[model samples]
Target: MSDEARVVRIVPNGPVMVQGPVRIEMPDGTVVESDRFMCAICTCRRSKIYPLCDTSHRRRQRAKDDESSTTVTVQAPAEA
Candidate 1:
């Protein structure tokens, strides 16, 4: 991202849509590039496509649909 870097919005229970010259780093020390200034990334961290929005999480509803649907939410919920 640059000085005028765009902000990536992490929607609750949804994807991380980013707008910018963003760089995506993989767990295997590989890096991916964003084509445009706007892109939707998986927030579930279960994307087979890694750094790209494959919609697999939405299709499978794996980590989502549960109580902890968000990975970037600020506050923790009260225990049940």
Candidate 2:
């Protein structure tokens, strides 16, 4: 623990996990520190908490499986 090494992990389609103490400086010079052993940093920019990951990256569940898999490629109308 004396070494104080910090580790970061990029979760697939998810947050960036940071281990150990970390200080995050915002755009306006506001500093946020993590008290937990690990913290999730938002990557999708959808978090209400800005830099923190509130699991906003998760995809919404479709009612039907076909609805989830369907990809509708729309064609533009021909110019008159």
Please give the CA lDDT of all the candidate structures: 0.60, 0.66
Provide TM-scores for the models. 0.54, 0.64
lDDT of 2 at 28: 63
TM-score of 1: 0.54
Lowest summed lDDT across 10 adjacent residues in model 2 is found at: 66-75
TM-score of 2: 0.64
lDDT string, candidate 1, 13-79, tens digits: 7688887445666555566666556666877776655566656666554444442322321223334
What local lDDT does model 2 show for residue 42?
83
